[model samples]
Target chain A: MNEYNSLLINLSVFIGLLLIGYFVGGIVEKRHFKSILEREEKLLYFPVINLAPRRLVEIGEDLQIENCFFVSGLVVIGEDYFKRILGFLANFFGGRLLSHESLLDRARREAILRLKEKAISQGADMVVNLQLQYLSINKETDSQNANNSVEIMAYGTALKVK
Target chain B: MFITNIDYVPSLKIIEHYGLVSGSTVRAKHIGKDFLASLKNLVGGEIKGYTELLEEARDEAIDRMILQAEDFGANAIVNVRFSTASVAQGAAEIYVYGTALKVS
Candidate 1:
């Protein structure tokens, strides 16, 4: 009877935590997506390119080349409890982990946006030769309960055209 | 000193070259911050602590690289590149490398 009661208690705690994660984590994720959308809209005009322009003279009339410098932005994003729970299950089944995928997507986009902002703040007409890198800060524990943190970085050269 | 990812500087000409200058650092997460991060992971958003950690590491590595370039009597570091790796559990390595050049 005692053993059964203990098991029941543990199960309840697990369910209770999951319920909290479901509601609270959902709200957080929604709010984050909304912010990302709004910020992206605000930053639409900050042009970023992956290739260096063939000729600087061919750039728009407004830009007169002055100087160029390097810029970078880094963002570290973590998954919510709800996503963690989903990831745990996905690990068991061995397939694409969508929960972690969305987390990385958000991180990558956010990092790029921040990089653009940095370039703009440096009086850059535009950013070129863009690059991105990602890292995961996952704890080494038993397979089931291990947690992972994802980080992304975006970098480029900002041209200060006068 | 000027630093850029591009090999060629539009205005400045490379007078001399100093091969490759590089720096790297490995960092381990603290237990306290790890616990806090796990808690923050529950509701999910940016982990400020880890972000700061990575930024600091990167800056340190870059600073070290600059120090090396200065020792080599270079005026600038070009083709600057950054890389990170997971050396061990709860630990990460940040590396920065570039070609040192004297420009005029």
Candidate 2:
């Protein structure tokens, strides 16, 4: 009887945590997406290109470049409890972890936005030679409860004109 | 010194070149921060502690690379690239490389 009571308590706690994760995580994700969309729209006029300097001239702007410097942006995002559980289930079933996909997308976009902001602040008209680097931290642990986070770094060269 | 990830800096000419310069660093967060990060994982969001730690480490790596370029008497570094690896369970290694050059 005591074992059954303890099991009942454990199950209740699990359900309660799942509910909290779903509601809280969903709200946070929605809010983040809203902010990302708004900021992206605001920075739409700025060009962040991956072209080298030589090819950049082909874009037809007679740019009398004055100064150039390097800029970078980095972000680290983690998965919520509900999504982590979903990831494990997806792994067991051999399919895509959709939740993680959005996480990555958000991180990448955020990093780019930050890079653009930095360039804008430095009086750069455009950013060129963009590059991205990805790294996963605390992923060495095989345990299910391990904390896993992804780091996305966006970098480029900012060009200014006279 | 001017640094960039492109082969050439705009409005500048590379007068001299110094093959390549590289810098690397391995970093791990403290136990307290790690514990807090794990707790934060329960809710899902940005892990500020890990982000700041890695950012600082990356800056340090870049500084070291710049120092090496300075030793080579190069005024600029171009074509910079970054690579990362997990050297240990909790440690990450950030490696940056670029071609050092004198520009006019």
Candidate 3:
């Protein structure tokens, strides 16, 4: 009887945590997406290109060059408990993990927004030679406190033209 | 010094080259921060502690790279690139490199 009672308690705790994770994770994700959309619209006019210096010349536009500098932005996002459970199921089935996909998409967009903000602060006309680096850190499968986090870094050269 | 990620700086002429300069740094968060980050994983959002740690490490790496370029008597560095690696279980290494040049 005692063993059965302990099992019942454990199951209830597990279910309770799952419910909290689902509701809290959904609310947080929704708020984040709303903010991302609003910010993207505000920064839509800023031009960020991946073209090299030579390509700018090939474009045949007479740009009055003034100065240039480097800029970078970095962001780290953690996977929520609810999404992690979803990802595990997807992994077992050998299919796409859509939850993780949206996480990465958000991180990348946030990094780019930060980079553009820096370029604007430097009085840059446009950002060129854009580069991105994505990293997954602290993935210890055996550890209880495994930090399943993704880091995104966006960098580029900002050109101040006259 | 003027630093840019492109091969050339706009409106500037590279009169001399000083080869390559690079810098790297590895960092790990403190136990307290790591514990907090794990707790934050439950709700899932931006991990501000890890983000700040990485930004600080990257800045230090860039500063070291700039010092190396200065030692070479270069006034500028161009074609700068950044790379990151997981050196250990919880440590990250940030590496930056570029070509040092004298520009006017």
Candidate 4:
């Protein structure tokens, strides 16, 4: 009977934590995604879209001289976010926020913007072959520390419609 | 070279010195090769993020530049140079350019 009661207690805790994590992930991850979209909308001037459904006919205006540039930089997200992720992970057994995928995804989005800025400064009308790169600074030794960070970059040509 | 693929397209120009050409895009063996290169870097290794992308992009950019020359009726493209950027860890950009010629 004692053994069964202990088993029941452990099971209950596991389920409770799983439920809590999912809720946290839903909130935090959604916020990250939304902010990234907002940033992109404000920055790049070209008619580019994220993974732009098809690689055809981007719509925009006025033929301008094609220009190109490349941009890059690094940044860190504070421990507050980091702690939240950790806290969720510590509680998680299943059902939500399984990994740090959402966090990484947002970083990629921002890095691309840096590259776009570099291209735009060159007075490019559009960018082509756009790409993203990342270097995880906090994956290990610094994982949970506030100082942990990563580098993010996006680059492509700025072109003017000919 | 300027892209003529845009709406207000222009006809290909053939130069006496240079031969028939419209525009060319360079194809690279290393599509996402940079990612591999970074792995090679390991801990304390120099980051060569822009190497692959820049190399490929330069070639493509150059091919396009030459094509642009053809469109302008230039016989040859001269003074080609390449510029590169390590936009981020996994991404790179390359641009190439040169003077268009129509030598008599």
The candidate maximizing DockQ is 2
lDDT over C-alpha atoms for residue A90 of model 4:
68
Candidate 1 error regions (>4 Å): A55-63, A94-96, A138-142
Clashing pairs in 2: none
- DockQ for every model comes to 0.70, 0.76, 0.75, 0.04
lDDT of 2: 0.87
The docking quality of candidate 2, as DockQ, is 0.76
Q: For candidate 2, lDDT tens digit of each residue in B1-104?
A: 99999888778888999999999999987799888887777777778888888889889999999999999999999999999998788888999999999999
Q: Using Cα atoms with residue i matched to residue i, what is each candidate's TM-score against the true structure?
A: 0.91, 0.95, 0.94, 0.37
Ranking by TM-score: 2, 3, 1, 4
In model 3, how large is the Cα lDDT of residue A106? 87
- Reference-based lDDT, residue A32, model 3: 88
lDDT of 1 by residue, A89-125 (tens): 8767988887777788888888988888888887887
lDDT tens digits, residues B1-104, model 3? 99988888677788999999999999987788888888778888898988888889889999999999999899999989888787788887889999999999
lDDT ranking from best candidate downward: 2, 3, 1, 4
The predicted structure with the larger lDDT, 1 or 2, is: 2
Q: How would the docking of model 2 be graded?
A: medium
Task: Give the alpha carbon lDDT tens digit for every residue of B3-103 in model 4.
Answer: 22221212234344443343333333243544443332221112244333333454466567766776777755433334444344333444554555564
Q: What lDDT is reached at residue A1 by model 1?
A: 100
